[model samples]
Target: MSRHDLQPKADQPHVVRATVGWDRPLQTFFAQVFFRTEDEPDEGEALIWLGTEPGEMLTPEAVIAVVAPHVEMPPDLAERLNAEMRQTTGMKDGRHQAAAKRSLFGSIH
Candidate 1:
C-alpha cells in the first residue's frame, strides 16, 4: 500500500507517514530532510516551506529538530539517517571509500 494510505487519524497517534523533502541549491548537492506525520495531509496546500533563509543549510540535524515535535523516532534512527546521508554525499562525489577511510582512521599523512 502507498504511504499516504498510512496517514494517522486523530485517535491513532502511533500511526504515521514519512514525508520527505530536500533543499534545492542553484548549483550543488541537495540537502534532504524527512519527517513522519500523523496529521491529515492537506489536499491543496503547499506543505513545505521552500524559501529558506539565504545560505541556510538544512542538514540532517536540522531536519531532526524540525521533526521532533511531529513524531517519535528510535534513538539510533536519527544517527543512522545522518550516517546514511554522509555516505550518500560521499557516493555522489565518487569518494566513498576515501571518505570512509578518513572517517575511520584519519587522513593519510
Candidate 2:
C-alpha cells in the first residue's frame, strides 16, 4: 500500500470501513464508506454512501462528505480516505495502480 492509502487499523476489527475499487458482487468501480458487524459480515453493512457511480471515477470530497453526517468524523479519517482515493483512482494524481490492485492476475508463466 502507498503512504497515501486510507487504510483502517489492522490490529482490530472495525465497525466502519472505507474501500476503493471494483466490487465483484456489486459489480462496479466505487469508493464506499459503510458500517458492518462481525455476526453478519456478508450483508450487514449500512452504507453511508457509494462514492462513485458506475463508469465514474472516485472523488475524495464525495467520500469525505458521505461520512460527515454519520458521526464526528476524525480529520485523519477524511484525509486518509481522500488520499487513498486519489492514489487508487488517480482522479487527481496519475494512476499508481500497483498499490490498488486487489490481487495478482493471470496465471503462472
Candidate 3:
C-alpha cells in the first residue's frame, strides 16, 4: 500500500512537529510568542512543542497563526514560504507529479 493509503482517515488528526533551535534569532522570536501566554510562567528557556489537528485541508493561515508571533517575517517572505510549502506538499499528490517534473525541467511531460 502507498504511504497515503496507510495514513489515517481524512477526519483523523495528523500531528506536525517542528523543532526550532534556541539561538539569538529563535530566542527573540519565542519571547514574542510566549509574551502573551500567562499559563507559561517560566519562559526563560524551553523546548516548545505545539500540537494541532488540521484535518484534511491544511491552510497557510492555520500554520502562520502558530508561528507568526514567534518570528518576524516580511509579507513577501511569508508568501514565498507559504507558496514553497504548498508546492512541496503538492508532490504527495500523484496528479501534481507531472507539473512538479515540469518545474524541474522547462517542458511539460
Candidate 3 pairs with clashing backbones: none
Instruction: List, residue by residue over 1-109, the lDDT tens digit for candidate 3.
Output: 0000011223322212222211111111111123323454343222333321113214435434554445543455436444544444423325464475467544333
Of candidates 3 and 2, the better by TM-score: 2
Candidate 1 segments whose C-alpha is farther than 4 A from its true place: 1-16, 20-46, 49-58, 93-109
For every candidate in turn, the CA RMSD to the true structure comes to 11.2, 9.6, 16.2
Best by lDDT: 2
Cα lDDT of model 1 by residue, 33-58, tens digit:
23334444333222333324332534
lDDT per residue, candidate 2, 1-109, as tens digits? Answer: 2222233444424435555443322223355554566765754464544623333434445544544444344566646545544444433212333333323322111
Instruction: Give the C-alpha lDDT of model 2.
Output: 0.42
CA lDDT of 5 in candidate 3? 8
* Stronger candidate by TM-score (1 vs 3): 1
- Cα displacement (angstroms), candidate 2, residue 66, comes to 1.4
lDDT of all predictions: 0.37, 0.42, 0.32
TM per candidate: 0.38, 0.34, 0.30
Arrange candidates by lDDT, descending.
Answer: 2, 1, 3
